[model samples]
Target chain A: MSLSISYDSSFDGFLSVVFETYRQRLDVGDIVPERPYDSDVTPSVDLFMQPFHVETNADSASRLRRAVVNMAGEDVLNLLETAFRSEERGVEMKILAYLRVLFSKSDPGFARNPTSSEMLPLFLLARAVRHEAGGMLGMVRFNKAPDGSYIAEIEPKYDILEMIVGHFRGRFPNGRWAIVDVKRCYGAFYDGRHTEILDLPDTDTLSRSIAEKAPPDEFTRMWKSYYDTMAIKERLNPRLLRRCLPVRYWKHLHERQQNLAGPASRPTA
Target chain B: MNLQEKLNILGDAAKYDVSCSSSGSSRGAPKGGLGSGCSAGICHTWSADGRCISLLKVLFSNACKYDCAYCINRRSNDIPRATFTPRELIDLTLEFYRRNYIEGLFLSSAVVGSPDATMEKLVYVAKELRTVHRFGGYIHLKAIPGASPRLLYEAGLYADRSSVNVEIPSDRQLQYLAPEKNYESIFRPMNFLAERKLEYSAGKRSRYTPKFLPAGQSTQMIVGASGESDLQILRLSAGFYHQQRMKRVYFSGYIPVNADKRLPALTTKPPLLREHRLYQADWLMRFYHFGHEEILDESNPNLDPDLDPKAMWALRHPEFFPIDLQTADYEMILRVPGIGVKSAQLIVSGRRFCKIRLEQLKKMGVVLKRAKYFIFNPDVPANLRRLYPEMLRPLLIARPKPAQLDFFSQLQAPSLPAPAQLSIAV
Candidate 1:
């Protein structure tokens, strides 16, 4: 009989599932995240495939981690972690299939091949997550609160709030800043010395309140001026602008709030 | 003028400088500092023209002494001009930076007084940002030609990248367009920065040795201004890349903002395709190990408007094609028309595990439409042996539609807007 395995939707929990599956010789019909893990836009769940819960084992997780590191290189292990963190539906099983492919091989060079069906899906998934995270690194615009703290709200496609925190932390080592993932309602708050991932109140309300508190500053006016004047009128390309930056990101990007399609292209309504 | 007016005027003037890349330096925030440079660079947004807006690109000033015919802020033109005090520039940068509106500052200036005086003001901002404010963000300072080597050295100390735009391709053309500028002034600062970067990185490091030009130097050249051929531009770009630590060589398609006897007709379209082709050739030279001579020679003085430079080169030398993907080296695979750097690297590593099938080749990011004719496998027809250059040329070349001339616009989707708000009846 085929078995369905479920874990607590953490990296450690996923690793624990990898260990438990190998030890029990579970014929994995499906592997799943316990807490309603939804993909980017759609809320999807298969009614036929329900998973029985498996307790997360730290010892099991660590042993598998060491084995994967010893067997394939750290790069392979990193690829797996990045893939799992992609938070896409059916990702857990895709990662499992990839791990099966890796553990089946003796030579680490076999893991380098990305053309296989097992490996390619995981690579595409990891790249999607990393690509979104990279965009967030640039796209997050912090609005200074009246309290002298920086607060920014983002609604990323994936759960990448934790992924991009390192960049902001490094960029502003001495300033207090908070980046909140509005969709997930959690944030990484940096206090100049230490960073804490805190569950916050409804971010929509928080962001709206912050906007009311601090009006646009002089520098923001300066930035808007700089942004507007930078475009050469002769080469006005609204078509190219939409391609580089997808429109969904415009909802959160403060500068794109007004008629940012520019006066030339704004007559479409 | 107020700070707002200066920012708008100077920002508009500096828009044409190009080179807004904030990559290649991992300048982390120091203890008690405000920001760090992103190694891969974060483009905050793209401008209306589809250019990346990574830095707060603005001129420190636009009050010019030289009368360059191509420039908007030339001494000959009577545009409203403005210059920023060092304090004002610093304040503007820090505030915008803290709010994450920009990655860092890209400060270029029209020569305010002499080149040395202008360069000193630029250097003063960098030094103050690093030493006084403890700012650790990316700074790209335009090394004004004819600035003293000492000032350029100090500018290198604090800035991640220092670049000097050799505006015109050849010296004679430069003399015709920008008479006050010459080859010596442009090359002098470029040579100094390259040598200094080499000096800093060559030996064992002491604790006190500061990083000099961590991102190295870059240069820009205007295309189609003096009617220089693609051959001339590529050769000059190749020369700069060969001679110095040129991280990037930017190509600006000339927009005729001024009328001069030596310049092209005002009605002539800016040679956008030629500028783009030059960049593609530059990319091939840097990444694909393509020599400049291989790209352009005595016969073809221009890049083909229909086919890309790589495809053109492939058609010119048909002997290289029908490459056996299984046996060819990475460099040889890269030379194939459809395969890019990513696919080439993938092919080399992937063939180790299993034979790459036709289906798997598409999965590996190969553009099957373009790559099918070049690669040899069981799936690609054996009858292609009779395929000659002339027939293949029409098949491979994408005949340019007006929008298709820009590769980006070919894939561009119309902007998605949220449902429009209902206008209430008055």
Candidate 2:
């Protein structure tokens, strides 16, 4: 007798697929995959693959949603976010396997230790993503982008493009905005209507792109003037400033507007 | 001044202000805007001293026009000076934020021009950071004394927090030392800002209540820099706490960075231990339900420098000791010398389940050395009752000195000229 297996790409899809596997009880030796692949199904294995096509208006999606609630408790579903963020595919599978065991056991451990076994993989992934998100939180220099929306460019260490955008969305809830992760060739766009993640051309090579067709406003001048005027004379602590704000992030700040707009007064490097 | 030079001077000049406590502000990053507020920003580093360096705590420019005698950057001091454009400071803040270096900006300046002029500059920096940069990060701007109320109010709209350092602990001390700054100059704006914050909060408007320093206004009083008794200083602190609604009364033990004849020579290192004791007293008053009068009365206005106020109180009020653990109220337990806030809560919670024995208290994480002599119950072993006193003193005495006061350790023995004499600022 051959054992069969199936797969689903998303967590929700996977839950639905798993539910079908148990409910249909098609055969003792057959399996189905949520995502289709160009592989020959072994005659002995008896495997089947299906794309997780959520019928846009289908109430069946709610059944899949219910399966998610049953298999992984709402809390586990939340914890699985980190696993989904894991760039490593193996970790994601391990997380899924762990979730299966949890659902199968219906153990209190799923509820008791949410951040531990159930959520640790996702936490590790969120931790990595948070670094870039945090850096973007600190460094994304906002300038007036074309069409009056605010735009910032960042080079984050993780694929936290969505998290970064989400943080900014709260900070400037009213503004139309976009933050492109220079390294990952992706960005999140928040129009007044909705926020969407988008992939972009790998524009990392362009080092000195100007804001497209936007004039320097009065606030910029006042900001420059204010910066020029506020530092004290008797107590200069460059060492302290360097320690606090490393020079690495000075490239995009609006204070650099003067240096960027004018001819280079001195050698930066 | 050049940007680099300004960054150096202003940043150094601004190091002494200890008012920035980042824990209160929990706002995250904005849409299309960069940076979120973290309790632990780079400049926001909390030292063993427990001081938070969350902001670019720097002076706009340290060139002073007023001759405040206690000030190291007094107008007459022949010190190297530098100034930054607001743009540079904000750039530095953004860069630091990006690099996880600083939480926000803590911009103070010596009176370079008239008070209005100096305040206008501070206001401009805050305004630029908020409106131009759309920066929602924490900002603590210093409200220069004698600045117009309008400027002060405008400054609040842009910054999260603001303060005017009271300098000396008392008006008399202020008169003797910082003649250019007086109680009215400082308190007027403080009072106005307090009212404004109240008004804004009461209006039930936007969640962005435009906090006129949500961390609340804090004032630095130069400890050991003035002749005011600890009692006098604490009274002033208490008054500020009650009337001005000051969030913190920072005690900066004067370090005597400059020399002057009118100032008193130090008998010992600027009373750092004394300053530390005052901070402990402050903490007790704030958290331990200690009343200002209860900690210090007319007979002994100053707390004993050798022991923490709570310990000293316990040693003096011995009648309250050997409190019955099983019968004591949580508040009474908290008042015991050995019991801290956490221990008191534990005792309250744990006692509800069963009769608590002395050994069980230790297992449940009670501070037995201090609490042992103060608490008694049927479960306490007979040997434990006799042995507890020995345990108490050794534990209390062995407590690690507060790190900030360790600056006084150099004055260990009187034989070595009592360290360098320090001139009192007030």
Candidate 3:
């Protein structure tokens, strides 16, 4: 009989499900995150299997980690981590399928064969997340807070706040900064001493706080002036500009924000 | 003039330079420093022309003694001129860095009195940034062609990368365009820096030896400005790569800035296609293991503008066709039209356990539409076998569409957003 496995939405939680799948030898019909209505499912002939809740524990997670490392190489762990971070539906199932292929072999080289059906989509998803993270490394524009901290907000398609925090910490050592993943409702913040991830409040409260601590008008004005003066008039190709810096990214960019002010009213600073 | 006006004049003057890379250095933030450099470059923004604005690319001064025909900052050009005080430039750089608007500075300049004087000022700025500010960000300085060796070395110590532009490929054309400049002045600094880099690297075991141009040196060659053949240009570039160990060779399609009688007519559009093809051929030489002669020989001194260099090479050498996917070596697999570096690596790894089919190749990022003609895979359709290389040539050539005939077509129909095409990996 098929079993519907459910767990908390996290890497360790997913690992716990994998651990239970092997321990019980259950035929997993579907692996999903725990939902409120999971207990209220009406029994049917086609869906006769009971839902199984796999509690996430360190021991079980570590066992699955060891199994993955032994079956596949160490690199597959990174692929799994990056792929698991993606916000795509059925990504957990895909990871489970890929791991199953790896665990089945005595000497599985799934990492080597990136073109395989089971691994290709996972790699692509991981690449997309990485590409977005890389773009954010450049696109993250920080506004100076009144209290000497730097504040920035981003709504990345994937959960990349954790991936990009180290870069900012390295680039701005000793400087207090907070990078909020607006869509994810959490932020990675770095105080002068240490870095931490915190759950953020709503957008209205965040924007109000950001405005209160925003840098002086002169800095933004100077940046806009610099951006406007950089482009050559004769070689103006907006198509190419849009290609390099996509329109979606322009909303948060300092230069693009002030572009609507027109050249006449630009501040001299 | 005010700072904004000065920026306007200087930024416009420096826009024609195609090199905007802020890569190749991995300098960490020093104790009490402002920034750090990541080995992989970060492009902060792109200009209207689609070029990356990685650094605060600007000229220290637009006051030139020599009159180059193609340069906007030439002595005879009637344009607004400005020069930034060293303190002002330093302040600007630091402010921009704090605000996260730029990666670093790509400081180039026009001849101010003499090459030695010009170079000294540039080196002084770099040295001050390194010593006083303790800045760890990427700095690309222009190595003045006729500067003293000591200044060049000092500049290298402070800068991540240095370059001396060989404006015209051929010496004759350079002399014809700018009488004051010559090949020796440009090559002298390049050869000196190249040797110094080698010397520094040889004693790299010692921690005391300071890094000299850790990003290495690069040079720019203006295409279509001179009457030099692609063969000559590629030959010179190969020599630079082999002998001088140059990091990059940039090709800027000559943009008409002034109405010089000696230059190609002012109305003539820049040779964008030729420049693009040269970049492709350059990529072949650097990454794809193709030699200079293999890319462009005496028979074809120029790259075919219609087809990419790899496809053109495939068309010319029909003898090496239908490469078996399962048996061919990694190098041979890389030669296929549709297979890129990533896909070729995948092919080699995937073939160890099982024979790779065409569908698997497509999944691995191979452009099967183009590779179908060149590769012999297990799942390749039987109908594709009837067609020959000659029949595929016309099909492969990317023809301009009927809608593209309109002058304002690009304006009306926006092109899909994509990454910068010219940022080459070293």
Which 10 consecutive positions of candidate 3 chain A have the poorest summed lDDT?
Answer: A260-269
Off by over 4 Å in 1: A1-7, A19-27, A34-51, A55-59, A104-109, A209-215, A259-269, B399-426
Scored against the true structure, residue B224 in model 3 reaches a CA lDDT of 84
Q: What TM-score applies to chain A of candidate 3?
A: 0.81
Best by lDDT: 1
Q: Which candidate, 2 or 3, has the higher lDDT?
A: 3
**iRMSD, per candidate, in listed order:** 1.4, 10.1, 1.8
* Global CA lDDT computed for model 1: 0.83
Q: What is the CA-based DockQ of model 2?
A: 0.07
**Tens-digit lDDT track for model 1 on B82-199?**
8899899999899988988889999899998989999999999999998999998999999999999999999999899989999899998888788898898889999999999998
Residue B298 local lDDT, model 2: 92
Q: Kindly list the per-residue Cα lDDT of model 2 for residues B1-426, writing each as its tens digit.
A: 566556656656676665765544556655556555554332323222334345667888888888777676888888888777778777877655443345677889988879899999999988888777767678888988888989999987777667788878888878888777678878899999999888877856777554555666788888877788888888888888988888788887776666766576633355567878989889887888887888888998778755678877776676677678668877788787767786577567555445666665665456776666666777655554444333555556765656665545656645543334443332
- The digit string of per-residue lDDT tens for model 3 on A208-256 reads 5665667435666776777777776656778888877878777667677
Residue A116, model 2: lDDT of 38
**Selected candidate, larger DockQ, 1 vs 2:** 1
Q: How much RMSD separates candidate 2 from the native structure?
A: 10.9
> Per-candidate DockQ versus the true complex?
0.60, 0.07, 0.54
Interface residue Cα RMSD of candidate 3 after superposition: 1.8
Residues A1-269, candidate 1: write the lDDT tens digits: 56677778888998898888888887787877765324344435545655567889899899999998987778878888888877777898888887887788755666777777888878777888899999888898787777898888788887788889988888888788888777677789999889999976765576566566655665666676678788888777788899888887776676665543221122220
